[model samples]
Target: MPLVRSAHERGITTLTLDSPANRNALSAGLVGELTDALTRCGEDDSVRAVVLTHTGNTFSAGADLRNPPPPEALVALLRRIVTLDRPVVARITGHVRAGGLGLLGACDIAAASRDASFAFSEVRIGVAPAVISLTVLPRTDPRAVARYYLTGERFDAYEAARIGLLTVCGADVDAALAPVLDGLRRSSAQGLAETKRLLTAKVLEAFDRDATDLSALSARLFSSAQAREGMTAFLERRDPAWVL
Candidate 1:
């Protein structure tokens, strides 16, 4: 079955990430599926906007440690979201973590349920959120990033929005997204495209300039002995060697 399911209505293309077994983690296959789905939307002139959502209670748990996506693939997928002609809105229905936060940051706008939580979980596992920083650091508040990136503590949806990780939070994410989609449906395609370009030019420049360096940093950390032991301990449900 496809990892991503795509549907269209009223000029809106909604791409639902469907890999719930691992909380819709960004595995190589899932990223590829997402890229393909977005490419299709790009080609279809009728697609006025896109909504990225997920099927599970967790929007994503970030990169699947057991079967992670290729660094290039993950970065490319994020770039695709930012560069797509139509505005990309993320409907975050649940908790988000690590690289999953990257997905949220990449979208032009994101709305989450009031109960949704978020965190940068990489540091706790002995690796930093290097690759994801390309998208996330640009959107989130610098101070919040300093704390969460280092501590890996979870925060609520309201804080996520306050920190600029989400555009809005509500009892129902769909309710938050309704007005956003309504506004998009009213925009001329050309206007939307140009506006997005204007909004994303800096982010696109960062991707071009920093993605390679960041991906390399992520790869190095993930392969380090500390990260190996940390990931192993996490998978084994035990404290890592460094745990006090």
Candidate 2:
């Protein structure tokens, strides 16, 4: 079965990340599937808005520690999310981490449950955010990014919203998302497209200027000895040697 699933109704398309076993980790196949879906939605005039969500309690655990996807694959998926003509809304639940935070940052709008938590954990695993920084850095509160990026500490949904990482946090995430989606549905396709373009112009500029270098940096870090050890230790449920 495909790791990503799609459904459309009333001009709204919902694409769900469905690999619950790994908390919808962004494997190569999953990213490819998601990118393709987003591309299709961009082309479908009937799809006025798109919801990017997940099926399990854990929204996404970021990269697959055991078999991480290429940095280019993830970069491409995030870029598509940013450039897709329709409005993309992330309905976040459970917890999000590392590169998953990048996905959240690329969305035009995001609503997370009050109980949901987020973290930038690459530092703990001996790598930097690298390619994801292209999108996440622009969307996040600069102050919040400094602390969370370095400390690798988790923050709750309220903090996420406060930092501009999320549009809103609510006791019921779906309830919070309803009106946002409804409003998008009411927008003309061209209106949403142009508004999204205006909102993402800076991010798109960064992508155009920095994506190649960032992807290279990501590939190098992930292949480094320290990062390999960190990923291995994490998969083994142990601390990397660098951990004090």
lDDT of 2 at 57: 89
What digit string (tens of lDDT, one per residue) describes model 2 on residues 1-244?
Answer: 9999999999999999999999999888888989999999988888999998999987789998776789888888999999999889998888999989999999989999999999999998899998889888898889889999999999999999998899999999989888887788788888988998999999999999999999999899988999989998988999899877
Show pairs that collide, candidate 1: none
Question: What's each prediction's TM-score?
Answer: 0.98, 0.98
Tell me, by lDDT, which candidate is best. 1
Output the lDDT of residue 88, model 2.
90
Per-residue lDDT over 137-173 for candidate 1, one digit per residue giving the tens place of the 0 to 100 score: 8888899889999999999999999999989999988
- Return the lDDT, model 1, position 141: 87
Over all chains combined, what TM-score does candidate 1 have?
Answer: 0.98
Off by over 4 Å in 2: none
Q: What is the lDDT of residue 67 in candidate 2?
A: 69
- lDDT of candidates 1 onward, in order: 0.92, 0.90
Clashes of 1: 0
